[model samples]
Target: MEKEKAHESQNSKLTHENRFGLGSSEHVSIEHDPDDLWGDSRVIVNIGPTHPAMHGALRMVAKLNGETIESSYCQFGYTHRAKEKLGENRTYHQFVVYTDRLNYCSSLLNNVVYAMAVERLMGIEVPPRCTWIRMICCELARVIDHLICIGINAVDLGAFSYFLYGFHQREEAYTLIEKLCGARLTTSYTRIGGLMYDAPDGWEKEVKDWVVRTRKVIDEMDRLLTTNKIWCDRTQGVAIFTKEDCLSYSYSGPNARAAGIDIDLRRDQPCLFYRDVEFDVPIAKEGDVYARYRVRLEEIRQSLNIVAQCADKVKKGPIWSEDKRVKIPDKTLVHNTMEGMIHHFKFFMTGFDVPEGEAYTTFEAANGELGFYIVSKGAPRAHRMRIRGPSVYHYQGLDLMVRGEKIADLVAALGSINIIAGELDR
Candidate 1:
């Protein structure tokens, strides 16, 4: 009882002196108590709408008690491109370019998912070769995205050399993408009913060779970064989110898998050549920054396996559906005949019509279960289009994840989740 009274007295003595309006200065002066560890240490810190550690245009408003975040909330939409709104205004084929901007780190994944959604609406199934080629592209994109995520995560944590190892592989992957489509960062390779172009003659062999080289680099990175004392100390047990927290926030993909959720859309809800291929989904129960990194690292290896399998399965065949309604006219036919030229002009000008029905297609994209919800009214464009980017849901949990963690851990948590601003703010 005496100790309780003494503690109350100490708290009473530590009240802010400026609460009674006794000062002209804006600063609040608190009476220091020797027993109080947080005396005058609580303050609000804004971590970015423009900061390097943020990875993108993410703003974290945190209330800090010394070095630890007492409470926090995140803010986004600094780069609102209104991608969904643009979908309604443009034809389905034209919107493929917009999807690329969502998760630019793996634009091919976005391209594939959007095309799948449109194809489902039209009841079109692309050829076997196209399906196998898409699987390879999706897996390659997955590796590229994971590499960027893990590499950037390391960069934020002061592992500069670690990023370089994955970065070289990413550049090689981008070169392959460039060969498939003329563009690198914003690749609109998938048309509504098929691919913009078929893989080059030696593309499969090149992809297999790249995968082999990537495997070696990944192993080297694992040896260098996994057991490093500084990395473990900084990441291991920091920013933990329980499985319940992840489910509550609608988390999917590696971020959810790291939190002990074993759901992968490719395994549970198979699409395209996913049912035919074999790849393991990596899971971790710790749900910390380190666990997320490890999951992505393992996923990269699995992606390599998928790419190799797909390279073997892919054969020379038609890469487009037989649906004349959605198919683009051949270049030779367009140049030789007036009928083909008119058809080609019409295809580009009016676009292809989808049936009067709604379809939502979700794919196991690099980050998570990326879904596209399209409502069609049998027109050239969708009546309404909604994109379910994983970054938005993952970003929502940042406040809960960062509370009681050090400010530096916030950087680790944000990078670990790999929130691309284009996806988050779209």
Candidate 2:
């Protein structure tokens, strides 16, 4: 009778725990030998604050049952440097330099967006030539950024040769950018009203040469991976998001276009020199990792076309606008005239006044839409500045892609998202 009572009591306790999800089979183990009750049932794995596949300092705590992932949660901020707080404290010009640290792959895009936002608040109009030049440089940045995304993704999928080829082409693009602006990675080349300096003499010829070489490299990359059976097997049907799902999440760029949504800020809501240029936005229907890869590859071709046209139309004129409020007088002029000297000193020290208002501007960055929201209180320092980085949006959508996917597919999904932790955490 006592044994029966004890058995009922233990069964009631088990039932009570299971009903509340506190002692389900996943969390509990029954042992014939009571001494063995302390053995581990749950498998805990740390996927990396330093893992090779993690891309950056992103970590994932994954719970596994044998080889299958039961649940996973991501951790970030290992690379955080409090960029927003720094922006709040710095002057507008100083903040432009910090923008480069957001997404190092496409730093120029960030610079352009931030500068444009401030310029809009100040009602500063950039010259037509300067606008075109900004477009050209940002497009070049798009190509460089996409090359890294596609190549690194391919590497994650075991296509090492494609990564090498992509990197080689990207190096050529970077060389052109460096030659034009004298900076490589973090190009703080775009100024508030225009570019930091004029494109070097013979820049058109260098850009033309790069355009031709890049086209050949794009063809080579296509030949290497586009129809390869192994490449398709690895990425073709992996990590798909429907168009509706993409829109619901506010996805943009190749990520949205991969799901068959036709929305390119360059074409739809034209800004800078995009309104004057003619180019097609490549899109794919599958929304898979392979589809995103294909879309970005085609975009490289379109970017080259834009660069070729810009090279032909690029005028030899002042890189900065004529507005005295925004542009400091040329150093040579400052030496020649008292008015130029005083204007130069005042512009450098006091800066220009921006009316109290807010503006949001977005550009077609390599990964997606890169936007800046700025608030001005008629001061040299912005009252508030916010960045709507594409990587942040992509990071938020990751769990949707990862859940119900195989453990290996998580790597593919991460690559498809193409998130830069610096942008995400910032």
TM-score for each prediction? 0.92, 0.87
Candidate 2 TM-score over all chains jointly = 0.87
State how far residue 60 of model 2 sits from its true place (Å). 1.9
lDDT of 2 by residue, 390-422 (tens): 887787777676665667888888887888987
Candidate 1 residue-wise lDDT, 1-426, digit = tens: 999987875555445344544445443354454544555557899988999899889898999877788899889999999998999999998998999999988889999999999999888999999999888989999999999999999999999999999999999999998999988899989998899999988999999999999999999999999999999999999999999999999999999999999999999998897888888999999999999999999999999999999999999999999999999999999999999999999998998888899988999888888999999998998899999999999999988999989888999999999999988888
Task: List the pairs of residues colliding in candidate 2.
Answer: none
The Cα error of candidate 1 at residue 239, in Å, is: 0.3
Off by over 4 Å in 2: 1-42, 334-345
Identify the candidate with maximal TM-score.
Answer: 1
Point to the candidate with the largest lDDT: 1
Q: Note the Cα lDDT for every prediction shown.
A: 0.91, 0.83
lDDT score of model 1? 0.91
